[model samples]
Target: MASTSSNKSRCATCGKNIGTFTCRGCSQDFCLSHAQEHRQLLGKQMDEDVILMHDQFQQCLNEQVKQPSLHPLMKEINEWEKQSIEKIQLVAQVARQKVLNIISKHTDNVIIALTSIKEQLSRARDDDDFFESDINEWKENLEKLKTDLNTPKAITIKFDDKMNSFIPKISVHKERPITERFERFLGDIQIEENGQLITHGNSNAHATVRGKGEYSSGQRLFRFKIENKRTS
Candidate 1:
């Protein structure tokens, strides 16, 4: 009889007395009066739990679906971005090529222009040499004329008034002895401050000599001594 009472004290679901009912679906037990109500409450709670679980499962599935759908769109967007970058690079390359071509053309034109200018400059330099030669020839002719004009000479000529009008008026010459002329021409020869000998005389009697340390041949020398002449 004591074993029977002890067995009746056990819970119906888990067969242990934990002092409360637990639903079967949720692994809970109930007393005699609350058994039916507990079963009904458990059935209602199981239905609500199943609906909640289904909602969670459907949410997970919807998230998975959205992830797959977004993957293709993301791939398309990335591909479009890559394509746009490549197109931009291609356009930049073309523009760079065009700029380089223009620069090359400009450089070529500059080179050609410089070549032409160089050619013109060469021609001008050649012409300058020709002019220089002409100037040198003229200078030599002038030196020769100067030497001839300075030569001492005596001439007897009747001058007409018309010829005198065209001719330059010059002072009459004072005759001196040849020795006296020579002495006068040589008397004033002196070494200047710059160590160059300076002679003061008529154009035909002028003479000069460089200093003792400096001398060269072909330097200017003149003599204006006349021979004996009877008084007219």
Candidate 2:
């Protein structure tokens, strides 16, 4: 009976004799010596597997820290900033060009008027026919030219207050409609407090002071508080 039983069962590893134990997990039978060796081999393999997985996880973490992906919204905001600045710069350039052109035209017109006056004065002096009236007229023309050169009433800056925009729109106007209540004035008048107030001097007692604006058709109301007045 003993010989028959021994022949019926054999060691899984060495196959030298009948297996003394069977593993519950793998369902493999092993002799006593082979069972201990199989347990050691499984423990070694478990350690190697743990080490490999740990290394892989660490590599993944390092990669994540080194090269993080930028958010989509961040890229979008950057592009918006670039485009907005470019647009602002372009508008600024255009404004500068317009101002230059206006200044050039104004200077050219002044020069032409000055040249005509100079020719008239030279001819009158050469012929010795210049009267007091001619001298007075030349003086008046020169004074008007000086005033026009100093104050460029044609150039007006407008701002769009109706629209709600990230950047406000500013425009330069050559012949804009007179919108403000008091913008242009003639005589010894001074504009103060950003055109909110006007002061007149009695430099010419007989000369009439006139405040004027070009309007096709409109009913306008004006209110003024006299800060100071001179009765001479």
The backbone clash count of each candidate, in order, is 4, 0
Give a tens-digit lDDT track for model 1, residues 102-220.
55554564566556655655776787644775457546655654453343122112334555564332222222212212222244354443432344443444464432322265453
Residue-wise lDDT of candidate 2 within 126-224, one digit each (tens)? 999888988998999899899888777778777776787867877788855354545666677777776777777758543333345555786755556
Candidate 1 lDDT for residue 45: 80
Best by TM-score: 2
Candidate 2 wrongly placed segments (more than 4 Å)? 1-79, 176-232
Would you list the C-alpha lDDT of every candidate in the order shown? 0.51, 0.76
Model 2 quality (TM-score): 0.44
In model 2, residue pairs whose N, Cα or C atoms come closer than 3 Å (at least 3 residues apart or on different chains), thus clashing, are none
Question: What are the runs in model 1 whose C-alpha is more than 4 Å off?
Answer: 1-74, 129-232
Query: What's the lDDT for candidate 2?
Result: 0.76
